[model samples]
Target: MKFKVDRAPLLRALSHVNGVAEKRNTIPILANVLLEHDGETLRLTATDMEIAVVEEIPSTATRAGAVTIPAAVLFEIVRKLPDGAEIEFNQESAEEPLHLRAGRYATSLNVLPVDDFPAMVAGDLPHHFTIQAGELRTLIDRTRFAMSNEETRYYLNGIYLHVVLEGKKNYLRAVATDGHRLAKVDTEAPLGVKSMPGIIVPRKTVTEVRKLLDNDGADVEVALSETRIQFRIGSILLTSKLVDGTFPEYSRVIPQNNSRILRVSKQDLAAAVGRVAAISQERSRPIKLTVTKNHLTLSAISPDQGIAQEELDENSVSYDSDDVEIGFQARYLTDITDQIDAEAEFALADSSSPTLIRDTEQPAVLYVLMPIRV
Candidate 1:
């Protein structure tokens, strides 16, 4: 197979697929990328079993053929080539090695038989929908932070995406939690896939799909089946296997009635917690919030280091009953506050309770954090 493609277009497509290709794995074929030229367009594909990314773009095909080359090597060669250099890929047959040529650089890479490259059978996806890339990005950005990394609970390692009803209106909701914190966001669901099957989108797939949505004003076509989901972004397509376990009933963990509400400037609150926690103990990184009528004091103390305290002028900070003392992970508070551009509030019942951090203005997103013992 012989084909010529612009360095920029080829690099962009290869980078996306490179994300799923492993640098080192027990399976030799998993470490390489499959390149196929169908006479007019060249298709590049890479997969790590769980996720696969494919890109098909216009290229000049001299001899129609395919080859498997090291993903990292191809990416690096294209990346280091001179500006505007066109890359030439050639493979005489499956037995011969692939040769790459660009400017003064010429490299030969061993090729693996394309048939050995594991191919994932696309399921019969009955549900097809179109979603604005901008909206999908919001769902990912808001809840991805809460996805668990612990392997014991495999379901928790990915975001739970489903189409459901919020009251009477249909909405697409993304929920993620790591046991200590939870983030949930919802938006109007695209009309066509109202009956779309709910699935656990794996962490790597979530990350890759988010990257594809970065281009402004792009529309992504989504297709879902029982075991996999496909996302078509521009000329690129990604297919990911759905994680197979039931996510915990996270709705039950959210506290509905936390009477004490503490409203504070997002920047001011995040700053106070950040500064104080720098001197707090390492185990807890706990900062105390003392709410009063018109002032909120943030303080943290570490016997080995020192004490840090700061106060924010709260228009009204007193609790429903009296001033309440609550301890929280300073980092968590700062992260939640940073997510909101506007001023926010945290509702709490007492020192030993979950806190609801919410945007003071937006109606769609909610973050919950379980209190940390100091």
Candidate 2:
């Protein structure tokens, strides 16, 4: 197998596989990337069993064959080569090592037989649809922060993506939670997903898919099955296994009615929480929020560090509830508030009930944060 490719495009393709190939794997071949030459295009594929990504780049191939090489080493070598240098890869025989040459730099790497590489069988994917990249990105960003990282309830370690109907209008919703907080965001549902089943996209796969949504105008083609999902972006395709555990019915956690309402600037609340949190430690970084008449006071206390308190103008906050005091993890408050741009409406039932936060202008996105005991 022989091919000549430009450094820039080759490096870009190599980067896509770094995360998957460099991950710790028990199988040696799994650390390598399969490269196939079809005389015109070079196909690069990397997989860690759970997820696989393939990208094709233009190249000049003198011989048509395939070989597997260390993806991390190859990427580093190609990245350090002089700019504009053309990379020449040659493997005379299956037994011989793959030879790489770029300007004055040259090296040979052990090659693994392509047949030994694990075969990724993409079973029948019956459901297919397309969504704008920008819209999909928004859905992920709004809810990803709330995904559970704990291993016990593995089902909550991903975002639950499903299609819903609101007032006869179709909508796609992404919901994530970690027992402490929950985030739910909705967007107009794309065509052909009406019959699609709810799927829990793993945290790692969600991150990789998010990287492909950089182009706002591009449309991402999605294919789904019972346990697998595929995303095609330009010349790249990513396939990942869905989480096996069943997701909890998130609807039950959402508060149905919270009579007390408070509206304040999202920026102000975020800043106040951040400042107070500075004195508190990670494990017990709880901030107390006291609301009365038309005023809100934020305070945090730490045994080792000094206390912090900030008072905001009563006139700037609009509240219809009686005086109440609630505690929350300062980091959690900042994370949810960061998703909102303008005014944030806070609905509180009491000091112990979960608080619902929402942006008045974006009714489609809602965040539920459980109160913390201080």
Candidate 3:
């Protein structure tokens, strides 16, 4: 097979496809990317069994054929080539090595049998919808931080995406939790999404999809079945298997009657939490929050490091409920607060109950953080 392509376009396609190949693969072909040329365009595909990414770029081919080459090696070679350099690829046969040439630089990569490469068959995706790239990004960014990493409860290792009906309107919601904290965000459901089944999008798939959403105004076409989900972004296509386990009924964990309200500048609370948490040596790095009318104080103590405290009064916080003291893991507090804009509003029931947090500027996003004993 022989083909000629521009360095810039080839590098961009390789960069996207190479990430899907596993660095350590028990199967040899899983470590390589399949390249196919059809005289007019070249297609690059890489997969790690669970997820696959494929991208195509314009190419000029004199001999049409396909071969598999190590993804990392090909990516690095093209990435270092001079900008605007035209690259030529030549392979005598599937058993022979793949040769690459760019200006004065030339190299050959050991090739693998194209027949050994596995394809992720996206069987019969019945549900189809189109969403703005910006909206898809918002759903992922606001909730992915709370996804669980624990393997025991595999269901919680991804964001739960589902459709909900509120009165007359349909909404698409993304919910993620790691037991200690939960993030929930929703957007208006696009047409034809109401019939789609709830799916758990694995963490790795969420990350790869987000990386491709560089242009917010672009449209992303999504198609899904019960077992798999596929995303089409311009010339790139990503397919991933859905988590098989059923997600727990997350609504049960969201607090409903928490009425104590404390509003504070997000920047102030985050800074104070960071300062006091510095004193704790424990993994949780527990920080105590004492809130009263127009006053809030953050404190932390470690047996070896002593204690640290910071206070925010009427100037930075607004509170009018009975005094309450709640404890939270310092990292959890920062993660939730980081999603807030200028102001963060906290709804509390008591020191022992879960506290609800919200970005005052965005009503569609909410967070629930469980309290830890101080």
lDDT of each: 0.85, 0.90, 0.94
Ranking by TM-score: 3, 2, 1
TM-score of candidate 3 on Cα atoms, chains taken together: 0.97
- The deviation in Å at residue 46 for candidate 3 is 0.8
Models 1 onward score TM values of 0.95, 0.96, 0.97
Evaluated at residue 366, the lDDT of candidate 1 is: 93
Number of backbone collisions per candidate: 0, 0, 0
Could you tell which candidate, 2 or 3, scores higher by lDDT? 3
Q: What is candidate 1's lDDT per residue for 187-274, written digit by digit as tens?
A: 8988886888778898989999987887758899999887899999999999999989998888898899998787777777777788
Off by over 4 Å in 3: none
Q: How many clashes does the backbone of model 1 have?
A: 0
Tens-digit lDDT track of model 3 for 1-374: 99999999888888888888987989989989999999999999999999999999999999999999999988898888888999999998778899988888999899988988998898899999999999999999999999999999899999999999998999999999999999999999999799999999999899889889989999999999999999999999999999998999989989999999999999999999999999988999999999999999999989999999999999999999899999999999999998999999999999999999999999999999999999
- Identify the superior model by lDDT, candidate 1 or candidate 3: 3
